[model samples]
Target: MNNNPFCLPVFTDKWIKHFNTSGQEKRFDFIENVSFVKKSFLPVYINVGKNLTKGISYKFSNTGKDFKKKVFLLYDVPDYFELDTTHNFSSLKTIDIQQYPGYLVGTSQYPDITAFKKSRFGKSSLAKVNKYKRKLESSFDITYTLYYGDISRETYDLVFDKFKELLEKRFSEIHVHNNNLDPDEWEFYYDVIYDMILQKKASIYVIYDGDKPIAGSINYHFDKVAIGAIMAYDIDYSKFYLGFTIIHKLLEWAIDNGLEIFDFSKGKFGYKTQWSDQEYYFSYHILYDSSSLLANLLSSIMSLYFRLKVNLRERNIGMLKNKLLFFFKKKKKRATKDYKISEFDDTIDSQKFSKVSFDVKTLEYLKRITYDFLYSRSEHIRDIEIFQDLNDKKTFVILGKSAKQKVTFE
Candidate 1:
């Protein structure tokens, strides 16, 4: 909690500067709530991370005695903290409640990553992870690289571009807006990460397919913990479970690097829950002077509002929010024919096959399955061949050393 990357020096001036540029004054500390207390001129100190994705590390002064006059708002606080008790809010009122469920791996608790993972999933799961890694390695000319402390600017630019592309593409396919792609947010990441990398406070872990960075993860390192901040993978290689593969590589790297915790931050994603050894919750804390009736009422009201909001999000209201999001913000996707696996085999065909120039664009729809085929067969990308059937133009054949695969689509 103390080493929260968002609260660290890595983003010290950058985050608040980004905050200011977004028309949020940095001196709004005395304002209780922007949306609620804006007109009331109430004294409040809102301490939170960027967009509340992280809980800002705050030092208590005088055990809550100093800030009794101000209504303090802090959210996305980890459950491991007993701030209300430790702060001794005897003269003040503090309301803390669970917000988002968090998942993380207590890596220091284990001898190595293998032990850490086995503690979460059984021994068989390790085999499954190995199988996936093998599939990915066999599928493409892939290399796992961790760029930390020292990385060429050109390579950083190349990989970061691909990282943004992957995140944008993945989110676009699902019609969800990727906040990481936001111009201001992306700018901060692009600028801050390079400096942080040099300072050994951040890292970019990349899964490269030959010269291409197909999947990438950005992690912030603080003290002994590494926060799994942003991660995205090429959907084309998703059939090989690149998501699982990447996390395994990351965890492996983490263990080797002597990291203690691999915090998956705030999300309650299935993969995080599946791999993590610990389950916790981000809490929302409302601190206000109990002596003041108005501050107490405001704190209670804000607590009720946030508690209800988080509760609703934890329920069907969250699904409805997504639906609403899609309805309002969904982009007009391109009109593409329904993708179907199309393959033609010269061996099985009565008609002759031709090796005429195949449109690379046509393979766009077939990329995933083709990659998957390479994975299962352990075939190198160059070793595989494609053909068109003379009788049926829609049918395509994928010829490998051991066998041939076919796909047909209208």
Candidate 2:
């Protein structure tokens, strides 16, 4: 009923059937109507006729014997798009159809409540969640002790060294195949993270097992949401599920501090889904020069093959009982020598941990005293010092140098 001439349906099943029904089939051509310009690496345009329901036409070159003598018919349309900014498509050859890439898309608009509810520790429904909450009347011992402090220079160095050691031990166990993340890269990344945390738009939570920090997570806060940016755990404690426990502790801290949402960030993995209730589609777009026709054709073919392979893998993952479809095989390698525990004793200068030289034993005693005092008076230390600017905001707790006095969110 619309009067717009551009609003015509050009490629329809009825028109195709009518074309095939005609006695003359060799070198047949038909015009298809389209409103938008065809986007392709090559320059192309669409022709729309006056008859709104009818088709429009386009031309193609017949260059060599290598080209098909006849047009091949297929059930599915080829996945090819013209090079317009809007990404419109029209006709594609059978060869072009085989070379499309498969991709994933992620967006923030998707609701993840259902996925969250299905997580390993998630309650099935609102009623069940309320029931569970009601049953727990007392607080339990959380695995990690969260602290915010202006760590001394020595302490910073010690922490960074420990992190490097932990990364070396844990990377292989975690099946991290990226050979690019070497010690130097990690050190550089850590330095950047540490600076950001000190600037107060971020906070680093170190999880200690006794006097040793075995796990840690860096969090960035924005309004009511906290994003767990980077996390690492000592490989020696892998059996204890230290990573999960650390995350659990972080979430508990968020809830206690009145934070509403925890963003896990991007990556498609079963563990992420365990704590997340949503998924988003992510896509990739590639632009290539039309002058390199052979290269483009070959690349397109390879892309299509990979797409099919990835699709099959995804389908298999969906059918499996455990969504994390990975296999690990143990291989013996030369174990790195472990440092003696006494080397970390408090008898050494605590300042040596950074570069200054204060008695390590004195440092240890001071920490214990600070911990005891903070533990007892944490409730009184309610107001947290938060810094914010147009670009970023962060929440933090400040612990005094010589006193047990601390500052934190109420």
Candidate 3:
């Protein structure tokens, strides 16, 4: 056991049972390490072997309400550490800390893989996926394989090398070359994946075209949750849509293994929403021991700094949005007139379809269908118009600089 008084030892089944006997839905708190800290010793023993003056600082994602309340019970002024960081704060009650937003893709929303593929949206998505599979198969022999529960070291090393090569090549295509990603840079992931593999707590899925790996995903499993950590596909097979194909296979595997949650971990990706049922944020908290005046003062100062940082970010939201737009290579100017989605009907002119604005509901719906289309890329898009056909049916027209496409709502 660790000698640090600030750390809590790993709990056994007895402790878990005691805490979960309330008959409520059980929640598993995700942690990167086993050394734990209670709020009581946070001020003095926080730095552990380092220095007491530095205090303790920890970051947690997907923190349970029970755990948050426990921290609140231990701290004197719990609100002091709470950071106002989330846009969806209204969903959660007034807690001692703010939750930083994060994304999760889980199997809880769907009963089974079959049911998941049976929805209208699911059917449409799968149809496109199948089409891609057929197109890819015409060129090479395709196979999807998963490594979990006793993967040999030889297999682990081989797959890890291939994943690295594929990732580097893919990034190179986008002009995002990372020359520093040598063996040393990858050692951390290699060690973590290897350990998890030995314990049968990780899954690595790879899609191959003949003997060559085309795409791969690394996932860690813990207490019924599978977290997807790394994913990369060969740029050569990108046109075949292998990236999406590999994740679909991983989800199918998760269902087969009875995993409850399939967390994408972190990021703001458009594709994640396709398989996600809900979204929540992640927050970092640092609680100082109240008895120590110096620790309390430092902690209070740090909290104020974080709060001000968030406020400054909010004021300059436009700059951040523009940066995101540029990263996606999208146009920055708006071209259409603003109109509430509900107000769109046959009375609207088709000429106005070149540029159109939507209400929140329509904007969200468009995002789901287009997969963050506007935010990612609006180049060559002359106009986006919505109107009703002669039969009073909703129709969307995408008028490009030299091309046109029409979408009819069912």
What local distance difference test score does each model get?
0.71, 0.38, 0.49
- TM accuracy, model 1: 0.86
lDDT of each residue in 1-410, candidate 2, tens digit only: 12111122222222222322332222222212222222234322212211112112222332222221222222111122121232222223323223212111121222343333334353454344433222211111223544343555576676667766666556554444322144444544455445444544456677665566767876654445555655767654333455655655565566556665565643455556655544433222222333446535644654576468557656664334221221232322323322111111122222322221112532222322223333333411122111112221111122322232321211
Query: Which tens-of-lDDT digit does each residue in 119-224 have in candidate 3?
Result: 4245677788766666655445678888877788887888888988777655544544332244543664565556656555667888886676778888766566
Cα lDDT of model 1 by residue, 266-312, tens digit = 87788988888888888877868888877887888888898798878
Stretches of model 2 off by over 4 angstroms after superposition: 1-151, 174-180, 221-224, 285-410
Candidate 1 colliding pairs: 30-44, 341-407, 342-407, 342-408, 343-396, 343-406, 343-407, 344-396, 344-397
TM-score of each: 0.86, 0.39, 0.53
Using lDDT as the measure, the top candidate is 1
Global Cα lDDT for candidate 2: 0.38
Q: What is the lDDT of residue 48 in candidate 1?
A: 30
